[model samples]
Target: MSLDYLQLAGTKAKGKRPQFFADSDNERLLSILMAVAGELAVTRERLDTLERLLEAKGLLSQDEIETFTPDSDQAEARGLLQQEYIARILRVVQQEKEALEEQQHCQSNNDLSEIEQELSRI
Candidate 1:
């Protein structure tokens, strides 16, 4: 079975993100760190599986695996994967930033209304 890494990476989770820490920034950082840890764990498992399969078939060796290099197209695809991975990890931060911007925008509009009200009384 083939996995669509890019499509899966781009998918956003629905519903509000729960916070375990008092500070939202701490929560965001925790999310990012956990994502990194989870990615590392999955990658390690996949590498182990590949190594075992190759050894079983006598198709690859440790030295060859270490020295293997990708062609240009493969390199570009790997780069895209890396970008998607990073984006997934940073999603929390991006959400927080958007929320804060929206809050500030609303506050500015409210402030403008207050100023206009005061000006009308003059």
Candidate 2:
């Protein structure tokens, strides 16, 4: 798991650094995406190495690797993890969605209370 290959390509600037992103939000999102991409690249390299080793040992073939499918439970778990990965990438969106849902819930509760009061008056 040597990350020497993942080093950012550039020499450090001698003076004050210019902004890579237009704003703080873009900068944060870019950082998150870069980190995720770097990790995924490392994992992909390791998986490729493993596949080559297995093929060399006569235990697996390139065709088998391409066609590989998990069994039922494994497939389900993989699906769940895939969903989680998407959520992680869109975590800000997920948080905003949850906040909106909570706001709607409170509005709905208030509406319900108003309806009940009108009914009581009637």
Best by lDDT: 1
TM-scores, one per candidate: 0.74, 0.50
Worst ten in a row by lDDT for model 2: 1-10
Collision pairs in model 2: none
Any residue pairs clashing in model 1, and if so which?
none
Per-residue C-alpha lDDT of model 2 across residues 1-122, encoded as one tens digit per residue? 11222222212335653459888578657755864797599879999899989999999999998998899999887776665555545544445466689999999999999999999999
lDDT of 1 at 39: 89
| Best candidate (score: TM-score) | 1
What tens-digit string does per-residue lDDT give for candidate 1 at 1-122? 11465456546689877789998678878999999999899999999999999988999998899999999999987888788888778877766677789999999999999999999999
